[model samples]
Target: MRRAAQGMLATIALALLTAPSSLARVYLTQDQALALAFPAPASVQRRTLYLDAAQAARAGREAGGAVETRVVPYYVGTAEGRPVGYAYFDTHLVRTLPETIMVLLAADGRIRRIDILSFDEPEDYKPTERWLQQFPGRGPGDELSLNGGIHALTGATLSARAVTQAARRVVALHRLFVAPFPPPSGPAPGKGDGAPPGAPGAVRP
Candidate 1:
């Protein structure tokens, strides 16, 4: 009986040692991601934009997905007192677990980079850096979907879809609320025909 008990304990220990871990893997923090996105000579500013119901609806329509929050936080990079780029951090579920990603955009509202900050799913399900490289330069108008413009990820379809959706949503938000406004052209100063470049009634281009 004693021998049998000892063997059972050994088997249990072996199984525990070989079992897969379920903890979330953290690759980078938000500050680290910001540093990587905007290197030296580029200063980063944190900004928050509140979206009204109408604005949120339009963004959802453009992105083909729901806007998860009305209050959004983003970062802007500037150099030589001129705009450089934008960055947004999105955390969403990939399958039953949560994953956080930082989406970086160029000054023209195109995708520049994507970095996974933390992932709760198995490492195998995370998209590779090679796969993520395809996203750079994609704009809000691009078809950023699975098998549309982005190639499918074998055995990691859910993760791929989640990341794609997040990317689309961030770009849409930038285009709608954060892109630089064009110069006022509809009316002269004090004409009362349209708002000034970035005034209340100004048209966003």
Candidate 2:
């Protein structure tokens, strides 16, 4: 009986080690989470993003630290077989706990929404849904920081920062790897906006 109990204990321990740590006790599964972002999508494309040494360095630069995972599971949400948006959950180390945050990007690669999949930190450390709302519609070049643009949490600075950094990394990755992005086309040549270079009928000396 003792031997059998020991074997069961060993099996449990092994499962814990091999399972995903970010999704620790989370209520939402991958499909459900994706559905929240995209309702009735035609299909979800699954891909894996691999970062080489140089790529890792660049991603780290954007993240302001080493990314928690090198290999990321990427999902493309499509409708009618046309790509609508991109999404992927990344594990960010919030102090001691690695929290899973699912970032959704628009077709233009801007952050559409952020969902906190799982976090084991204290309740006080959890950023409220309103606080989380501040992330949507923010682009890669936007200055995303705790005190800079985003409101700072009272005592959850680390958690806030971790989430912010993760957002930046996702945007950076989109620009770096995700492709066929067109340059920001300006107004037609010889056509200017905003007062048309001067008032239409302004008196000139």
The candidate scoring highest on TM-score is: 1
Per-model RMSD to reference = 7.4, 12.8
Where does candidate 1 have its weakest 10-residue lDDT segment?
182-191
Q: What is the clash count for each candidate, in the order shown? A: 0, 0
Q: What would the TM-scores of all predictions be?
A: 0.78, 0.73
After superposition, candidate 1 runs with Cα above 4 Å error: 1-22, 182-205
lDDT of each: 0.83, 0.71
Model 2 C-alpha lDDT per residue in residues 1-205, reported as the tens digit of each score: 9999999999999887656553465756778889887888357777666555666676577656675555666788889767788887877678876788899998888889988888866667877788888998898678787788788877888888889888888887665555335224432211232323223211111
- Give me the displacement of residue 115 in model 2, in angstroms: 0.6
